[model samples]
Target: MAVSESDDEGSDRARGKWRAKKKQRPFWQELPILIVIAAVIAALTVSFVGRPYVIPSESMEPTLHGCSGCTGDRIYVQKLSYYWGDPVPGDVVVFVGPPSWNTRYQSIRSDNAVVRGVQNFFSFFGLVPPDENDLVKRVIATGGQTVQCCDDQGRILVNGKPLDEPYVKSDFAWVSGQQNATYPSGRVFGPVKVPDGNVWVMGDNRNHSADSRAHVSDELQGTVPLDNIRGKAVFKIWPPGRIGPVRAQDPQQN
Candidate 1:
């Protein structure tokens, strides 16, 4: 069959129109939709999947650090990990700060509703530092377990078994001569048994950390309810060299 010139001209016009339409669309015109999609994904990730958290203190030193004026490892807490599974001993968890946790509410300003509303919005994506009302610590003992400091050899005993705590930070190296005798505070804690549904949390940097030991006077004896745990710290996301799975003491070892 012979091709018609009109057909060729019609196809050329259609191609020209399509090209013109493509040129008419500006990148900025679609930017809002992209922004919306990004915001939604970030919100969902922070809310129910994983959330980034800045290590706020040296309490988890060697594992995580928030040394004053120093860069700390930023971690992603696996919020979905415990949705169907229970938190076990040795999991590093982020949880709501107890009333006695930190008296200084550094990020909390005047109790203005509008101000709080804005803060909450930014906190959702972890854009700003988390409120002082949040804390991170390692689970020393879960429900029905008894945690005590220092066996005869100066090791933390959980459920009567001495933990192989390679992560516990050493005190001043020069102190010398039976450090446990000199530092009973870190070496000798309670024979306290964890109550059902509660878990005893402590900082890995024992000597420097104010954890369950500091809160023993409270009714709950510093054992946070399992329900209070937000999630487990699963990975280090920042500090490129430090990026890897967060070291968690094996719960099965307990």
Candidate 2:
């Protein structure tokens, strides 16, 4: 059938209208949409895959630096590792502070709902520090193992065997401003057996760390439940000069 001239004109006009309706959105108008999309994707990545955490103290010093008047090291904690296996002895992990560990914690989060929501969003990208009591430490002993500090050579023992912890730094002359502030070894603690699904952790800056050893009097004997662990710290992502893979050296190997 031969097409009519009027029919052809009508089709052309319809096409023109469709094209006008589908014109590219202005860059400024599209930017907010782009921002929202990026934020959602980033939030999901931080929630399920990995996230960055800034060291808040000297607890894991030398191995992971954070202290007054110093640029804190930001670490990447990957959640996938723990999904396949539990944290083993020597694994550096980020976890929520248990009840006992939070006695001295004071959250910096704002009480105002609007301000807190803004903080929560920025926290995902690490612009703001997390307000919760999150801590990082090395696993000294896993479930069913007995952990205690100090042997004849002043070594921490797990399962009655001394751990050769090369990462431990008892000296703090660089930050503490005292030449004699170093401890020959970490403070002594119990031979408490870690409960099932729990781990005993300690900071690499042994003498200055308020880790599991400081909470032995707690109900769980200071061992953190495995469920409390956020993830294994895989890499140091900040401080250009100090970036490197965070070591999970097996202290029990010795």
Candidate 3:
């Protein structure tokens, strides 16, 4: 049971040498390790915590601006909100487009496998757009609610109550000649009962947006499944003049 001072000193010297070796590692070697760690963290953040999305169309205009030949608004979509509760009416959200809605969506990736692989890697870091058909819209009705267009005052009704949506930017010209426009789009549809676990969504730009209304004949009755929702768009982070929190006004609230 006797421990010698020489043995203890040898053990101490061995540990010191190892520490010195670690400290002497070249920056070039450490750089790769740091890069891999950072990449893993970025990937996880993009997958679960939050990610940035660029608005690709005018559908959410006056709320989120994106159009041809313009700087699109880049929004930060936070996944944490839905982890606490389901999306409510008026929450702006990003979701993968359903099959019916993606009929016209074309992937921007090149056909070459090597190029596509490079594109995929860059996309993981938010350097390039994702190849999927992702869309952004506002929740109009949730599971169990019946949504329909146009009261006498041209308002959308959800569960027999008219929604007061201040964010809507309708093409009033579409209804100009109508005697009493039933809806801003000048087209009437719905009274569609949203299936449980699905949400009826629409764009603020009613006349132009090909949202759930445009896909009503599809298998899911145009309602997006909750599972398709990527995240709640919490803030607009691009176009310095337009930077602000994305509104999540509950249209159902009186």
Number of clashing residue pairs in every model? 0, 0, 0
207: Cα error in model 3, Å: 1.4
Per-residue CA lDDT of model 2 for 51-80, tens digit only, reads: 888888998988999998878998999999
lDDT of 3 at 242: 90
Of candidate 2, the 10-residue stretch with the lowest lDDT total is 173-182
* lDDT of the candidates, in the order given: 0.78, 0.85, 0.88
Give the poorly placed runs of model 1, Cα more than 4 Å off.
1-25, 108-117, 171-186, 251-254
For candidate 3, lDDT tens digit of each residue in 61-138? 899999988999999999998998999999999999988999898999999999999999988976777899999999
TM-score of each: 0.79, 0.83, 0.87
List, residue by residue over 94-210, the lDDT tens digit for candidate 1. 988677776765766448989888887877775655565778898878889898765666667888888876677753233223444333254556778888988888788877777
Q: How accurate is candidate 2 locally (lDDT)?
A: 0.85
Q: Order of candidates by lDDT, top first?
A: 3, 2, 1
Candidate 3 overall lDDT versus native: 0.88
- Provide the RMSD of all predictions against the true structure, rounded to 1 decimal: 4.5, 5.3, 3.6
Best TM-score among the predictions, by candidate number? 3
